[model samples]
Target: MSMRDQAVVVGASGIVGQAVLRAFAETPGWDAVGVSRRLPVNVPLHARHVSVDLTDRDACASVFGAMKDATHLVYAAVNEKPGLVAGWVDRDQMQLNLGMLRNVLEPLQANARGLRHVTLMQGGKAYGIHLDPNLAVPARERWPRHPHDNFYWLQEDYLRERQPHSGWHWTVLRPRLVFGDGLGSNMNPLPAIGVYAALQKARGLPLCYPGGPPRVYQAVDADLIGRACVWAARSIEARNEIFNLANGDEFVWQNVWPVIADAFGMAVGEPQQQHLAETMPPLEAQWAKIVGQHGLQAPPRFREFVGQGFAYADFQLNTGKTGPQPPSLVSTIKIRKAGFTDCMDTEDMLRRWIQRYQELRWLPPRDG
Candidate 1:
């Protein structure tokens, strides 16, 4: 009989959840089950996929209740209202996210008697970055919670309230500007950047810096966060704690523009400050032709492929201001001190993931 422990990852179609799914799938002694309402383009081949609506309590109970072997849970799912960034502060969005967490946990707790650890995903939103762009440099996990209406707090509170009575412990990870492979993810910018570059190349134009004034920021490789989730699941130090995650470095968008341009086989051009959300959709026919010409695997229809990513990319890049903005840096010292000390250069990480998407056939190959 196979004795591998079960690792069930919810929101398995998201960038964050995909990373977690791969980590658990690749690791020894763990069987990975990915749960998502939508199927991701690149689910790990070793993992099993579960399709169930997390918003429906009965469905989650029916689904999770039968999984008596689930030993670890990674909750990376979130529901955001339409128009992307504007939904960050929406109260209904907050409640929907909270309820989804409740739906999964209540049944999982009742059925998965042997569940040992749970990992929850949060982001810079916990520090008021979504509401106020001028968050202080190097946000720390030690700081008192910011005054806000974030669903992160709601879900965290739910975990806190239940852990004292439950057999399993929980960990929360807050990562900055996550980048990885999840098609139609609400926020990964890879698809947006890839499509933008391809369209520009198709038009014989340079890859313009299509963003606003320069702003410094940090990013975490989704896979790195995934490994950390595995680390937290096994480490006693991670129990009932929160940690901030990053790529251990920082970069400005325009500063890295040349790297991005070269990746797409294009030269850097003038900063165009184009609103990707406003501009990219109208070029779907152009994208369709590029898809067939390059044998790209992404859906030809832009919305099916990108979801809110164009709008998300616009919000991330086109800040529409003339002055310097504060960088959303977060300290990873706590996690390192706790013993998971993995690190990578932000520029190298970007190059690697861009190449990965190309290899995955989600983007066109850089022409010779």
Candidate 2:
């Protein structure tokens, strides 16, 4: 019905979803529509957003049914459980995720007759990281599916079963600790770390490392992942393939403390382990005071702005761990060989995204 490629980015408000929506909208000859339960507050490229609860099949039909021009789909929507990690193995959680994807896909497949490609988001958990911390370093796309109960398996299986009949090809991306432009996401570390830095600065304290042991970890910028989605959509080499992605760099939390501390205009304080899930959420009053003091536009409620981010931070940051953790690495050689050769410097990424939050007035500016 439309002249250009219509990219419907499901979960458009999420970190990766937003990035994908922005990339497609900004690219030549593409129109991107954001579909999510709630419209994103800050849409890149000023793209249009539609509110659709993916869990509601009838609702999905009502909305996606009207999007007959949709030519590409980026299925980044996810239903993470409370507490974040435990739900990875929960049976109901797996089925619910599969159902959500089915709801989105069935309606689209029925209406969007021209749909040519689909992208699904997966992460390190696919390698059994939640069940066993010592997963093989630099996990690859060609390896056997790790023996684990994950919602990723459910959704991938569904896609594989349905794709042969649907006239669409799909690509699955497994990224390491995805980071960038998300608010209150169940797994994003940006808001949690930003608030932590802000609260520390407000109290006249240096930035303290609240995480436990120092483990080398890798992260993929949401923007890179977004661009990758765009590339995957058009690249024949990416059809029906899976790729592991990252920034092609690694960092230790303790080592990066200085960069974050300097950004907050604070000195490095003594390292301490406080379960952010336990300590950070209970400080809503304190966060509100900081918000008022800085005149930040952040949501007054901690949960509204941070979601389960603090808990996810503890998990990703290795908070309370007594020793070094085996690095959770994944290979991007496949994606690069497939023609999407994109990378970002992790430290520069940290600097820029932190600055982006400040520029949005959602977090305090750097100290002078």
Candidate 3:
């Protein structure tokens, strides 16, 4: 009820959640609780970590029973059943994602007496980006929710309905293609691109633009999203509103592909329209060999090493099916007007995170 001092980040291991944890560490007087199924190895020391399966209602209640001091909740967790993008419309995806949020929100709403704000994460799909590429360009937060079986709608509707009764205010942030540093983050595109480039260079192949057609694109840096979440919680103007979050810049694969290639010290191949899911599977053994040869961080399995981020990145980069449709973009004017003015250069954000992967040995060092 008093100005927020304690924040509970429900999906601490996720790209957005991890950024929230790190951001909270730098903000004075804010203690945080990080909730997730598994604790991330790199979580900030100032925050407390709780490993409670959010899908289990009793488990969630038990965890929050002791969190009465929590004044804010950031729900960044998502439940995407198998097949990634295909699961977007699956009934199970909707049920499971809605249920995960319910398990956490119900218990906290009942128990956390000081809770004042909630931040929920959504993505470009709300504008029908996954359903059809041509529906709209430069998606605005004011657009009607695209007709689809999306959990974003379900969760957002739930939040809006509860606002009058519940003491906490809420904000929904829709980001496109979040790029960040982390293993096991479902939507992180950096490690996937980092690994793909390293492997392709090893085989004496140029780093190719794997997706189809030149299309304009935008992305949100995980750190910026984290900051936005924090700002939304504290900014009175951000309450009960939806904001499209991005780096405030646009890019095309045809132009940035060569830059990515040069970062790995590989030649830039012609844009041939390849799918990484098809091409990267067979190279697992080769990745293992590279790990051994370079003494890189050897993950137990390649998939876990990069998480579903590999397939998700491929799904994101492929402009092939989009036809002559104009590029997908999201306007951030709403958030800027609300007074959160953070921005990042899209290309620099991607390249910087890839460099971080190399420094951490999560991906092999780029070739000289």
Candidate 4:
């Protein structure tokens, strides 16, 4: 990796994608370029930004064509919107991802001079959703793909099929819930939960846990994921492997609930007997209105609003492998071992997310 051996990040405008771009820019040997449907807000001054429709084969081809010198590719682009979750939504998030992969890989296979590796960000849903009670707690990469997880399975299949035949190294990173600078993110459960909890507290509403009783919930900073991506792209050990990345520590809902409540200044209250669907009907309605008002594009139906209030409920991750050792107990561990030692204070991260939500008018300021 050298200044001349640039790295191209697709979906550079997204939460994970942007973090990946930032990581590439900070790494010593590589220049970073971001390709997306639109130019990302506040792109780093050093990285190049190219706007292109990833769904269009020609457009994707052209973007990669212009990056002829790129030695690494990080596929981070994703269409964000929760409404596409239904089985028949036809948005095809998986297909779109596959198209981008082919568009980049095909050209690289043909013309790249020093193309060495590619890292694609994926999720835990590939293992299965709504895990059975008998299944082990803290799912591992070795777990077979859940038969029902079409999105993850499709993208993963594409990666597995292409890696050996294309002659380039590949790594798939499955990171459970990621939280970081809250400004432009849509998938993170933290920002929404922080905002919802803050608003509920401000309004004197009870704190609600939407999913199954408190299990373990894990998260990693987006930047950490980015660093891991860069490390994987540069290290031969990372090639053709799958890693589960998350905060090294796992906390039961009992633990995380208090942290969020304290950070948002919410009253320490017990879960309401009311189901989330009932208590938060208004919130759901409001979210729909907000989506319509902002004209934000929708994601695959499978992803639509599925994790809303339940972000902290049933989601648990085993971060011992992907996060830090001695276990920061709050941040990702595997990534730490992968050479990313930075950690974002969990409380601080929560507070900042709350503040950003208020600043963006997504949530209102507390009136003492």
Candidate 5:
């Protein structure tokens, strides 16, 4: 579809959602409508904003009912509840995602008019991770579901089952640890670390590395993810397919630690040889002091941060082999061949994020 058509974006207020809206608005021939629980704070006047809770079916139906000429529907909403088990973490997250899909699809299936593509945001968990040692690396779309994967499986199953029957085209994007712009973003771990580290530095405390740093980790900028989503929505080759999204670079946490230190203005001290739990208390105390000094809100306790941070940091995904894998990294040749050629400078992205946090007062000044 040409850029002149209308695109309806669900979860437009979120980091990724907002990025999608920004990207779509810049392209020619596209007018953007955003639907979310609340209107985004600083959207352009040309863009339309609608408020609706995805869990409320009637509200969702009302929102979809108004979009008669929409050419593309992008679902960037996700259901996430930290500290909850797989079964307990709001089946509604998956349900709301599937519900949004079905809500939009029913209209397309009935009218079969303007809908060109429906893109849903999923992540590495859909392909499973090292959580189960039994699983192998470089997980492909064809890999069997891991036993513990409940939420992603349900969503994937619904999409797979419904795509063929629905008239609208469909694509799924699996992005790894998206980091950029929205550091305090609910899903990104780096922001949490950055905030904590910044607070610690402000308090003149040491920034500690937990669990000897994760064995493997990679991240993509939110803008890059947005571009990929838009590209997938427009490209015929992207339909009915799943593609991995990352910065096309991979490194262990050790490689990233120096960057983190530099961002927080901390010395690159010797790596602490300790487990995550033992290292978190002092770091949390340091964070507390920094938060107090800056009058910023205190984050969740050290244990909570450690628990969540470990889960995110320790997980890794193979972003399919296609691009020039930098030295000492695995090949990313498969994804690059699929017309996905976006790369981001992780260090620059981190620096900008740190600056943003400071500007927003989420992080304290160095002397605070």
Candidate 6:
């Protein structure tokens, strides 16, 4: 709570972590650093960058030892395997993710005497949203844990059991679908949607809805998640609590399809089974052509830039082969009642981020 508090954001290159970095940079008297195996080329000048694999304990100790003055830690890093959903129940994935946090926290706890608060990012998956078709609507923080080998349970348990009794407090955030403009983020849906739209428009085709059955969903803007991180670290009421966050509204993709098509000046198409992992690899040449025609500055291998992000979008829209089920929602009342009232218009948030991708040449501009 001191004005000169310093914070370190693990997984700094990730969507949530990057947002945390920006939030800390904007604070009146906070100094922040981002930690990841690789640093983004365009990290904000006001922040410091540290490159160290959180899975490597000695490396973590070497890098974090210098941050004895750090007062806050935001752990937003994740280890995602090839199939995003399938990896949810994979024990190896769980161990890898748990190890990443342990490597960082063990070192920081030993070295940072000023460490006061720690924040962790969990998701709707914590409520069995990924593996259970019958997940209770409006998932709440107090719900009983679904019996699964989920890394969230492991990580949260570790944090609660390991935090030093006298110094630090911990909080967890469970956001549904997180949307942002991070190009290389394995979980970002924006570039996946953006590139898919650009490709469809380039081929004189409708901007199709590529995913599973039509079901309702919710999303939290990355910036909003970042704000919640800052608030949780600084507020007495938020400490030792887990809260669900979204844009404060729920939406069905079918209803928003037209809005997206219009944003790109394209026609809307019916929802279809489009597997991005199977489909995107074949579209690289076409993406290259679009890049050349538009003088865009995207990676020559578009698939590399977008990576598994598109697959994540596809999985999110239509929950794989299980067909449609009830809407997946998370109650945000806990965070709201606690006084972090920031909300985002989901449609507008998508539109703004898509336009930003165009301006940055990460995606082509809307074609006529």
Q: Pick the candidate with the highest lDDT.
A: 1
**Residue 222, model 4, lDDT:** 81
Compared with the true structure, what per-residue lDDT tens digits does model 2 show for residues 180-287?
877777878999998888888887888889988878888889899989999999999999999989998888888888988777678999987799889887788998
Q: What Cα-based lDDT does every candidate model obtain?
A: 0.89, 0.86, 0.81, 0.60, 0.63, 0.83
Which candidate model has the greater lDDT, 1 or 3? 1
Candidate 1: stretches off by over 4 Å: none
lDDT against true structure, model 4: 0.60
RMSD of 1: 1.3
- Models 1 onward score TM values of 0.97, 0.98, 0.95, 0.74, 0.78, 0.95
Clashes of each: 0, 0, 0, 21, 10, 1
- The positional error of residue 248 in candidate 1, measured at the CA in angstroms, is 0.2
| Candidate 3 per-residue C-alpha lDDT over 189-277 given as tens digits, one digit per residue, 9 for 90 to 100 | 77677778878878788877777666788888889988898899899999999999999899887788777776677788876676776
lDDT for 306 in candidate 6 is 77
Pairing residues by index, what is the TM-score of model 1?
0.97
Q: Give the residue spans of candidate 2 off by over 4 A.
A: none
**Candidate 4 residue-wise lDDT, 1-368, digit = tens:** 24466888888877688888888888877798988775665587789888888778887666676566778888876653343223312446656666667776776656667777788877755555433323445566666665563555566677778677566788888876677542344555654464356446645676655443434456667877887887788776677877778755554555666666665556667554333323443565555444455443322121243334232222332211232212112223444455645555555555665565445454444333
lDDT computed for candidate 1: 0.89
User: Model 5 over residues 1-368: C-alpha lDDT tens digits?
Assistant: 33377778788877678778877877776788887775653465678788887777676666677677788888887655564224234566656556666665565445435677788877666644434422455666655555653555666677677667555677777777776443223555664566546744665667765433234555778888878877887787888877777777776666777777777778665544443323344567667665676776434354333334433432321112233322222233555787879888777777776666666665665444
Residue-level lDDT tens digits of model 1 in 236-297: 99999999998888889999989988887899998888788888889999999999988888
**Residue 213 of model 2, lDDT score:** 84
Ranking by lDDT: 1, 2, 6, 3, 5, 4
lDDT of 3: 0.81
